[model samples]
Target: MERDALLQVANFSTLFACMVLKFPQILVLMRARSTAGVSLNSLVLELAGFIVFVSYQMYYDYPPPTYLEYPILIAQDVILLLLILHYNGNMKQSIFYAAVFIGGWKLLTVEKRVIDLAMSLCTFISASSKLAQLQCLWATKDSSRVSALSWGLATYTCLARIYTTVVMTGDVQVLVRFVAMTILNFWVTATAMYYKPSAKKKD
Candidate 1:
């Protein structure tokens, strides 16, 4: 196969892996109806980041993301929003409004600078969320509450980011995000190993 063909195949496989892991994590959250141990701050930041990232893609005329990526991310964000509202006993009208405003602005605007600014903002939000998650794990000394599926997703995301970084010069931001996520994943996984839930306690 030609070099471009090989790159395409790799990208497809990585995208598929990301979708597989991400969807399962969303399903787990939905079925559990409990963000009990999950970090709300992280979720909020992630939603913010995703909004920017998606907008960037749209503005830059990047190829359409896989169908699975869009739906899974939407589902995850919606679920997180609902969980926050329910737990805090606060209607998230403002959050919804903000999402709408930003999304609309991106859709209506044509300037490349505006899109670049959005991407930069989104990247910061994403980093903040990841850092918040790490802090949560460290403070509690318990990674048991984090969804296992998220860890799996991180692993695949790391692999995919590394591949993309090597193949595509424009993907540096994504590569950095994935690298940070991968490191956090290892930390959480190690903490989880030490704090496994006890079967006897459950009974």
Candidate 2:
């Protein structure tokens, strides 16, 4: 197959992986009902990053079919956040968090170049999410609360995107974000594997 065809395959295949992969974290959170080792800061930063990323995609008029994934990502993460709050018995605080995220996303509108700025900010913040998780692991040396499946799939998907960017688009502008994200995801995955929680913590 041509490079373009292969790139398309890699692109959609990575999308499919992301679409199916995110729920594992939520599921793990639900079963555990505790955010002990889980980094709420990481989730908040990730949601912020997703908001900007989605806005940037919209600015470029990303294809409707594939672009739908961004909103889906936002929705699922919102649900996950709500679930975490509920389990922590902070229902009122949950509402506040929701309000903040919703208001922030609504206020993201500006000029075209502003969208580019947001996208760059989003990429940096998204990578920071991984750093937050890494710190949590480093401080506690417990990967118990982290979801391996979720991080694993995310790392794999991001790597696939980097490959597609290199072989297909050859667009440095597009490749930069994915490359950065892949590095962070790989780091998180490595830490997750290196630190093993006790049996009770794993619950």
Candidate 3:
């Protein structure tokens, strides 16, 4: 019982940390009032991945923590996505994206196998989106809009969660996914470093 309690605490702590992780990113965007180094598509894809994972957990009737993580993650990303759109004068575009996201969410909620496949595919797609974001950062060599601290913390949190996951479930696929996400997070961090100075000069 004691060991289980400890594990539960660890699990919740990790999830909660991840849930609140985007706050720093949000702050970065709000303060700068710019989406210069950020990618709206990347946020959209991440939101999709979060939705699919949450749906998968719901389909299985997984633990509350699993289901709860969805809304928490969604709440953060929605704000980020909206902020990105608003700053980029793409708020009208968000309406269409939201419609499509809602429709996709509805479609995915219907079946178990579909949810499973989506979770898998969304994970890969989200990783790819992040990679694309990384490429953008490198090409522009300007990560002024990127929150290095937030990405660094997120990367560390994923690494910690990956350790906890391996210790708790020993699930190969989940481990692989976590590993993949961590690498992307690291890439995000590196992008920030690649463009260290705060004030980016226009060429």
Candidate 4:
């Protein structure tokens, strides 16, 4: 019983750390008042992944394994998604797309196996989009426009995920996902460093 309690505590701690890292992104976005350099595609895909994850948790009646992680993730994604859509002047389309996608998932009442598969696919898509966005930033040499605080938070979150995966072995697929995310996080950090953005040019 003691061992199980300790394990649970450790797991919760790690998950909390990951969520904490991501929480600041919301503040950063609000302060910047611009999602200019952030990738809308990445945010969209990430929102998809989070929706799938939350659905799976609800379907399984699983005590949300990560405590506050999912809630904060969903909140941040929603805010960021809205900001991106508003900035891009696609608010209506974005709202429609989100409603359709989430509604479809709910209507399907997908099985656990199917949910797992779909969630994995969404994770990959989201990660790929983030990588592409980072590549775009590098290509454009406009890292300055990106939020440094958000990037730092992402790096920390990825590291926390890695640690959590290493500590838990119940799900091989999840471990693999975290490994991929960690690698991608490192690449993003490197790009951010190498392509540090300059100050905004005078109007």
Best by lDDT: 3
* Candidate 3 lDDT over residue span 143-167, tens digit each: 8778788788778766765766666
Q: Ten consecutive residues with minimal summed lDDT in candidate 2?
A: 194-203
lDDT of 1 by residue, 1-203 (tens): 58778667666776676556555555655676555556778777776666666666565565563222544565556665675566556665647746774675556447777767766666577768777876776677554456666665666656665665566645666567667666766665555445545411342
- Per-prediction tally of clashes: 0, 0, 0, 2
Worst 10-residue lDDT window, candidate 3: 61-70
CA RMSD of all predictions: 4.2, 3.3, 2.9, 4.1
| Candidate 2 per-residue C-alpha lDDT over 43-118 given as tens digits, one digit per residue, 9 for 90 to 100 | 8888888888777667777554334456777787788778777887877898788788788776777677677777
The global C-alpha lDDT for each of the candidates, from Candidate 1 onward, is: 0.62, 0.76, 0.77, 0.64
lDDT of model 4 at position 122: 57
Cα error, candidate 2, residue 175 (Å): 2.0
lDDT agreement of model 3 with the native: 0.77
Worst 10 residues of 4 by lDDT: 162-171
> Candidate 4 lDDT, tens digit per residue, 95-178?
687787778677535566777777668568658767777867766776654555555655566556555545543455555665
Model 4: CA > 4 A from native: 1-24, 57-63, 165-169, 198-203
